[model samples]
Target: MKKALPATHTSMMRYAVLSISLIITTGPAVSSALPLMAKNFPNISLAMIDMIATVQQFTIMIFLLISGSIAKKIGIKPTISIGLIITGVAGIFPVFSQSFVAIFISRLLLGVGIGLFNSLAITVIDLLFTGNDKAQMLGNRSAMEQLGVCILNLVVGLLLLINWHMAFLIYALAFPIMIFFWRYVPEPRVNKESKETHQKINMPVVWLALLLFFLVMCSTAIIVQIPNIIVRGSLGSATTASLIISLNTLAGMAMGFLFGRIYKVVSDMTLPIGTFLMAMGAILIGMGGNLYIVSLGTILCGFSYPLAGTYAFNLLSKIAPQGSETLGNSVLLIGCNLGSFISPIGVRILAKISGNAFIGMFIVLLVVTGGILVFQWASKHVSKMKKV
Candidate 1:
């Protein structure tokens, strides 16, 4: 049954479904421990060791495109299970490996595993729920990934005390998540390909993907430049930086839990509101050198991302054709990962142009965020005029 308005899910199955997301975002976070890793692997070059954190992105993008076909052939349940098993096993392989090559391969396999299940995580929500229920769950899904990133990042700090390798053990959480998911979440009925076979994806999905790509790029700029903002601005110490990030993630979690209500109240205005808030944050951090002010800006940026992300995915579920939402999501994720991959270069360009990294980046971010609203307003206005 399509869940009605103001929807909520309280079942054990709900948690089981959300568990996969917790581990999905855990991969990129290994970058946080790179300094410690560099110390431990003295024989390996820093650039090569750094690649361990990113090598998965290529495999992940590859698998994201193909997993839809794989799901169509094998069915979603088995595909999800296979992905989970791969994630759990490959995620921890680094714990046993001292060789950079082996750990790099492990990270590659980890990306492959994540790509297999990444779109399906969103697809499963559409398959199992509907309407506000789906919207709410999508919000929670983003929250789950953010939560994983935050918590596991903290855990990685602690685990490094035990062994440099022990930090990799954090991925073991995926095993239990898989077991519960397999036992509780039933296999959803797969939609047979009919129109989806003949239909090329419509232009709106592509535009949305491009929009997502831009938003992700802007979002990555926020993280990339934060340290420079802290050190250059001399806002505070590393401890202060960590706290600021905590505030950011906590705000995101709160916003995500409340997204359903926000959407119900604002309807289509949700996107503009989110983008505005994000731009506001960028402006604050760019201009506000005060420690507390920067922290507030950080929180606002954090809050806006999941708010915008959930809305985008919810719209995708509506606009994408039946049996093809997964592929549409694939394109979106590709744009998303591509944005992250290229963000540093973008940051460098901004730094060179403005002669200041933090303020210059946010200045451009503010302008780009405004462009999103302009484009949205123009599109809606034209659509209304056509109907009239």
Candidate 2:
């Protein structure tokens, strides 16, 4: 029989695996550099230039539904390693080529790399830890992911001052992360019984995934509309809007770090609480006239968005049958990606109908989130009554 690693070693390995979150930074890191890229490729339409950032999202969505199945056959460690390598290579390919077509293709492939292993960060936590440990690890993973995004965005912005190509080097961070993963993370052991148990999907997982989809949809609208909201409200300029958005990211990082402790106190009510916070934030942003109030609203939404997402993932991990954490995560991933993609369009349609985009999104969020919270409360109350 093989000897088990020390608890300390196991914990270190878990953190190392969480570093895979860096792969998600690739797309967002380039977002700040898009104007520079447009100047470089003046011949390309602005829409096409924007596609360079968004094309990755489409590929990520396509692969998220299947990456879990692929991991089942190849094993998680290898799957994640391959993903990092693919992302690193694709991310750098744009540096060597100035062709719009070439860079677009490279970004699309980078999405594939991210899609391959994004959910594994969560799945690995489910595999390695249990109970509060598992919950804490999940929270840590979210925090690490937001931290990666924050750092990469800052790095890319600074690098863009030197040369647009230099910003692409941020993807190189994946190489060291891959090394850490291979050296510290061990393969999970899955028995035949556990494998069989995870193969069948649960109805609750489907419902939760849909809930996540709607939540993400509403949450993302806050990001998409912030600039417009600020300019229209005369709360700030474009620079001020960006700064507020960065603050929102910081708020998310902080909330993710605190999620484990918060979850302990709120237990199953975490999701409802998150929804309520988001609704309050949306209302503030919709109605506020001052910068401070809007910034506070942004922070609240940012905090609640990731908190709800973390709670959903933790719940899914518990309900997942053994080896099926990846599959369950993938389902949730689909919901999240679909919601993100639809948010801008959904908000636009609602705004058209309401004749005020900002207020329209706020109304949508309040109604939807309020309804979900009520449903959750009623469900819990009924369950308790039945137990009595």
- Lowest-lDDT window of 10 residues in candidate 1? 2-11
RMSD in angstroms, all models? 3.2, 3.0
User: Per-candidate TM vs. native?
Assistant: 0.91, 0.91
Off by over 4 Å in 2: 1-11, 196-200, 320-323, 353-388
Q: CA shift at 139, candidate 1, in angstroms?
A: 0.5
Q: lDDT tens digits, residues 1-388, model 1?
A: 9665321244777878888899886777777678888998899898987887788888999999988888877888788889988988998998888887888888899999999999889888878888787888888888888888888998988998887788888888878988988887877765566324733467878877876776677677777667667777788887678678778878888888889889888878788788778877877887767988888888898899878878988999778865688898888889889888888886678669987555665666567667777887898999999999
C-alpha-based local distance difference test score of model 2: 0.82
Per-residue alpha-carbon lDDT of candidate 2 for residues 1-388, written as tens digits (9 for 90 to 100): 9999775347668778778875674586687778888999999999999888778988887777778777778888898899899999998887788898999999999999999988877777777777877787788788887899888888888888898877888888888999999888887666677655646568888988888897788777888788887888787899999999988888988998898899999887788788778877887787778888888988999999888889999999667665677778988988988888899887778678987655675676567667767877898999999999
In candidate 1 the C-alpha lDDT for residue 74 amounts to 85
State each model's CA lDDT, in order: 0.81, 0.82
